[model samples]
Target: MTHTWALVNLKPGVGKSTTAVFAAQAAYEEGLKPLLVDADDGRSCLAAYNRADGFKWPVIGLAEPDLHRKLPDLDGGVDLVIIDVPQVEDHARIARGALRYADTWIVPVAPSHYEVDRMFEPPRGAADDSGRYRLLEFFEEVQDMRRSPADVVVSLNRTNRAKRTKTGPDAEVREALEDKGFEVLNTVIPWHDDRFRQAILPRTPGTNMRRLVRELLDRKGATQ
Candidate 1:
């Protein structure tokens, strides 16, 4: 069976597309036929695929409400499907649609007050709120709709190495997430422009990306 993983979050610029690309590449290197679905309306994943010379796998754009129904049918022989979803606050329908079919939900969060606060926002307005509250509600709805708890794995991205000490932002963010009952991954992707700038290039990812992939695979194994 194809294991589908969705890169989702309530905020943008959290490295969702980059993580999706790297995760799919890692899966490919692991002998899994990975199919990357650019479910974000921004089409950043598809753009990355276009910019990368000689990229081997298929990266398709399908940001629609019926993504859950259509994605599995397009799996072909793919062993894994990595979906780059839009920011949950902006495209709840598309994100929720992808969530319904995803086996694992990987949330990429930057260690910042803005991003961390958005993660735990409460549901406030109508169904059309489209804010962080609505985003949280969508996740709950997906759990009920699928009749199973969502397997959510949080990753701290764009971390600053200089401040990785006990009182640093990275540690604080991890503590906050854990306090809220979130399972934050130990592998933190540090903030490095050189590596991130080469995201669209057909080159090997940095150590953090590789470690993130390994952590994800290990988590999947443990869950199974």
Candidate 2:
């Protein structure tokens, strides 16, 4: 059976596509066949695949909302499928579809309170009337639509060495997420613009990314 993991968040710029691409790269390095599904209308993952000299796995663009139904036809016999879901604020349907389809869900968040608040922003003109993004609430709502509680983990991305230590932005964010009862991943992707931001191929996965991959695979193995 194929394993599917979707990188989702309430807002963009939280390393969703970057995490998707690198996670696929890491999964490929682990000797597993991995396919990347770009479910975001932004098409960032597709563009990255197009620009690469030799992308490791197949990347397809299916920005439609019926991912749970469409993905089986496109798995192409791969062992793993990593999806880059669009931000929930503007693309709720597509995001919800990806959430419903994937067995494992990863929410990549930066170590900032501002970003945290952005995740709670409700969709435009939403009746919530909270004047905030309803992303966090939306994510919880989607869980009920799933057959079971998916293995969801929060990945702290774009952290520096200092912030990742005992007390800093990383610690603060992790605590905040934990307070909300979310499982935060131990592997933290550092702030490396040349490596991660505007990423190019023919490059090796960084230590943090490799660790993240290993941690995820370990969790996958444990469940199996």
Candidate 3:
């Protein structure tokens, strides 16, 4: 994991696992040895590899807090150790442990208040799906309070083409994330059907995601 990177941060459906897994697939195509570590016990990354038969590289699976100690031991053998973390509250402890060790992190934002509200862990009931959708109004609020900022290039995920307006949540979220001092990526991962299919059936990333993965690998010099 010498040239390894971790996709940490305790936020589910934020594309942490999606980014980590696809990044591994992309790195594999480039001939870099990347290890996929499922730092979270649930929806584990290693298990997905076994199921996807997508292990173009080796994978390590561990429960909470183990990754913090395991990272040092595994660092020398691989080009990257990409770990997928769980959402906050559910695995905040594990998330903290992995973040403590991540060299670079890929964070996903959906541009909604519910998604953005992960920053402070809003009053449990105040944040429902509808409340989150209202994030456009509080864009400034999201940018002002980042709990764990890092050498992180935040990427927008699950963006819809037919947005409520025209630019969409992805565009809005990217602006807010950048304003918050994050290094945002240029590639936009458009919502696609096949990518989700590949996720369930176990195959290489489709064309669009593969290209994005290649860019990330190239940026990190993990490319051949």
- The number of the candidate with the highest TM-score is 2
Candidate 3 TM-score versus the reference? 0.72
Q: Pairs clashing in candidate 1?
A: none
Cα lDDT computed for each candidate against the true fold: 0.80, 0.83, 0.61
Q: What ranking emerges by TM-score with the best candidate at the front?
A: 2, 1, 3
The candidate, 1 or 2, that scores higher on TM-score is: 2
Q: Between the candidate structures 1 and 3, which one is better when assessed by lDDT?
A: 1
lDDT of 3 by residue, 1-224 (tens): 25546665445667777777777777777677778878776766765677867665777777567566778787676777777877655775676666666656676765665665564343345655434332222222322333433346666666664232236566676666666566766765666656653565434545545666666666666533
Q: Candidate 1, residues 26-145: lDDT per residue as tens digits?
A: 777767788999988788888888787536789999999778899979997988889999988788889888999897898899888778876766665544344445456677788888
RMSD for all candidates, in order, please: 3.3, 2.5, 6.4
Instruction: Indicate the residue-level lDDT of 184 in model 2.
Output: 91
Compared with the true structure, what per-residue lDDT tens digits does model 2 show for residues 1-224? 78889999877888999888888888888788999999988899898988885596899899999998898888868999999999887898998889898989999998899987776566667765665446656767888898887799999988866235678778988898888678998888888888876668824445677788888878988998
What lDDT does candidate 1 reach at residue 138?
Answer: 72
- Candidate 1 overall lDDT versus native: 0.80
- Lowest lDDT block of 10, candidate 1: 126-135
